[model samples]
Target: MADRLVPSISLKDFENRKGEITKQLLDAAETAGFLTLVDHGITVDEIEKQFALSKAFFDLPAKVKSKTPHDTKSNNGWEYKAQLRPSTGTYDQKESLWLQRGSQWPSDEDVPHFKDTTTEFLDKCAKVSNQVLSCLAIALNLPDDHFRVANDPNKPDCLTQLRLIHYPASENAVGTWRAGSHTDIGILTLLFQREGEDGLEICPGRESHSSFAMGDVFTPLPAHTGPIVVNIGDMLMAWSDDRLKSNFHRVRAKDVGKSPSRYSIAYFNQGRRDFVLQGPLKKYPPVTVEEYFNQAVQRNFARQQAATA
Candidate 1:
C-alpha cells in the first residue's frame, strides 16, 4: 500500500491569493486527483448537528424507514445495502439515504431539527463547492464562474446530491467490500467521515492507466475531526479535457474485529442533466449528463444481477 496523503488546500486563500491558490489547486487536481479543504466556512458545530440528525434517521425502525424508499426515477430517498459496483463486480456493504434540493421528503417529525440542520449544512456545502469551482475555472484559464454556473444545483435538471451512508459491521466481509472500487460519476465530491476510523482508499493516477485490477497499491484517507476531503469526479475530468483525474477509490473494513459500523456524508455536485459535457479544450466528445448517468446506472444493475445469479 502506498502511504500518501491527499493535499490540503485552504479555502481562505480563495479571496486574498487567487493566483497562488489556483496553482496549488491545479497541482493537486492534476496529480493526486484529491485534496483536503481547510478554513472552509462550514463550522464544526454545524457538521456535528447534521450528523446527529442523520444518526437519528438511520436509527428508526425498519418499518418506519421504509416510509421513504429509493426511487431510480427520482434518484432521492433511502436505499438498502444493495448498490452494486461494476468495477469490482460485487455489492457494497452499506445503506444510504440520499437527499436533493426541492425533492419531496418524508416529514421530519421523528428526528428533531432534522430539516433545519440539514438545510444549513447543504447550503454551506454549495457555497464551498462554488468557491472550489471558481478556483478550478481560473486554473483552466476560463472565467471564474464558468464551471460554477455550468453545474448550478438550482437548475431544474441538475442533480446535486447529499448522501448519508451507513456501513454496518459484518462477519463475512472477505469477498464483499464496504464499497467496491469505482470513480464517482459527477463533478466533485465533498466527503465527511467519522474520526479515528479508517476505510477510504484511493488509487492515484489510475484514470490514465489501463488495467482494471484493484491495484494492491492503495492510499487510505485518514479520518480527521474537521476538513472535508474533496475529490474530482468524472464530469470535472471531462470538463477539463482530461487534465484533471477522477481516480478510483473504495472502502475496506480497516478493522475486522472490535470495529463499529461506519458513517459518512458525501455531497455530489453534478452538471445539469441536459447540459453537454464539452469544454474549450475539446479533448473528448460532448455527452449529456443524463446519458452518462443512465448508462452508468444500467451497467451497475446488470453487474449486480449477474453476481447474484
Candidate 2:
C-alpha cells in the first residue's frame, strides 16, 4: 500500500456550502478519519507567537516550571514525560504543560506575555473548534448546532485543554519512541506542530476494522506549519455509533542527527463533564464525560506508579 495524505477541509466554504461541506466532512470522517483545516480564523503570526511562548516556558528552570505541577483530577499544569504508553510499556519522551480557559498561571516573572498570548490563541482555537463541531453535527443529521450545547464555552463542565508539548532528542532514539500508538480519548483534537519536524503517523480506517489485524498502512501526516491537523476522537466515534473513526497514531523518535527536538500544541475539545454522552444510534451505553476522561487518564499513567512511588 502507498502512503496517503489526509483530506483538507476549508472552513471558509463551510458557511457558504454548508450542505456540501458537511457531506465532504462526513466522507472524510468515515474514510480518512483525519483532515487538515485551512482558513480556520487563526493566522500564521499568531501561531508563531504561541510557539515562541511555549519555547520560553519550556526553557524555564526545572524548579520554576515545577511550580505549576499538574493536578491529577483537574488535568491542569505541567507534566514532564509522565504519560506512560500501554502499547509500548514506556513513557513518552516529552514534557507537556496543560491549560484551561480562565485558569491560573505562573506570573510572567519568567516569560513576558506568556499568559496573554496563550489565552488569546486558546480562545481563537475554541471558536474554530465550535465551527468544526457544527459541521460534524450537520453531517450526522442532527440540528446544525446540536453538539454546541454540550461544548458551550461558558459552562463550567465544558472544559477544554490546551497542551504545549516538547519532545527532546533522545540518545537511544532507535530504541525509544516519543509517543506509542494510541487513540485520542476526547471529542476532537486540533494539533499545531512546528514545521519541518517529521514523526507524526496515522493509520486511517483502523477504528471500524479489527485492532489486531496486520497490513494496516501507517501514513505520516504532513507537519507543515500552516494547517492544523484535526482528527476524530473516541468520544465522537462512540457518539457516532462507530461511524466516525478515531484512528491509532504514533510519533517516531527522531534520529540523533535530524533535529534536536520537536514542539507541538494540541487543543483537545472535550464535552461537558456533567453531560451524559450518548450516540444517536445508541450503540453504546451512555457515559459522563468526566468518568470517561478520568479512566483514560488513569490508564495512560497506570504502569508508572511504582517508579514515581
Candidate 3:
C-alpha cells in the first residue's frame, strides 16, 4: 500500500463536538494507534516562535548548552547524542533538552524569555491533552474526569515532561538513525514538528497487546501540517487493557544529505507519581506512575544492552 496519513481530528467545538471527536480518536487509537490533532488552540505563530527558541538554545556554544547538564534522576536538562536505543543498538542522532519540575535551566540572560515562553506553551499543550484524555475516558465507558483527576496539574503532585530535540544535519550514511525506533513512555505525547523536516515513520501494530520489535513496512507522516501529532502511549495502552495501541515509530536518516537541521518539541502528558493505575479490564496489574516509569526505563536499557551484546 501507499504511504498513509494518520487521522487528523479537530477540537474546534470541543464541548459540543466531544462525541464526534471521541469516536474518531477511539477508532484511531484502537487500530492505527497514531494521529495528528488540529484546532488544538495553539496557533502556528506560537509554535513557530517556540521552534525558533529551540533553535536558539541548540545554537549556543557547546559549553553553554552543557552547563545545565542532564540529570538521569530528574530526567531533565541537556544531552547530546546520548539516547542509545535498543532497536538499533546505537545512539540517536540528536541533542535534546528535557524540562520538568525542579529542572536546572539556563539563565534568562543566556536565552531571554525561554523559560517563560516554554512554560506558557506547556500549559496550552496540557489543556489539549486533558481534553483528549477526557474523551478517551468516555470512550472506555468510564467517568469523563477519570483520566483528568489523576493528571490534574493543580494537585501539587502532577508531573509532566516537555522535550526540545535538535537533529543536526549530516551525511545520510547507512546504519544511522535520526531517532531509533521506540514507543513513548507516558499517557500521551503531543509532538510539534518543523514543516517539511519529515523522516518520521510508524509501523502500526496489529495484535492483541503491545510489544517492541522492528517491522519492515512503515508509513511516513508529514511534518508540513500545522496540527500537532499525538500518539497513544504505553500507560494509556495499559489503562485501556491493551485496547489502545502504542505503535513503534522512528526518524530515519534517509535523505539527510539533502535535508536541513530538524527541530522538534514533545509534551509528555503523565499523571502523579503516586496515582495507582488499574484499568477496568485489569489486563495488567495495578502499578503506580513512579514505579511504572522505572520499570519501563529498566526494560529499555536491558534490551539495549542485550542487543549490543
TM for every model, in the order presented, reads 0.92, 0.90, 0.95
Could you tell me which residue pairs clash in candidate 2?
A: none
> On TM-score, who's better, 1 or 2?
1
Best by TM-score: 3
Q: What is the C-alpha RMSD of each candidate to the true structure, in Å?
A: 2.4, 2.9, 1.8
How far out, in Å, is residue 133 in model 3?
Answer: 0.5
Off by over 4 Å in 3: 1-5, 206-210
List runs of model 1 lying over 4 Å from the truth: 1-5, 171-176, 208-214, 298-309
* Top candidate when judged by lDDT against the true structure: 3
Better of 2 and 3 by lDDT: 3
Q: 106-210 in candidate 3: lDDT tens per residue?
A: 778888989888878988988999999999999999899989898876565676888999999875544367898888888889999988888888888645334
lDDT of 1 by residue, 1-309 (tens): 232447887878568877777888898889888888889988888877777777888888877777877887877888887687766676688888888887755567867777777888888999999988898998888888887777898888788899998887666665346898888878999999878766888887655321234456777788776789899987788778878878889888755464467888999998788877776788767788787677666665776677667
Worst 10 residues of 2 by lDDT: 207-216
Each candidate structure's count of clashing pairs? 0, 0, 0
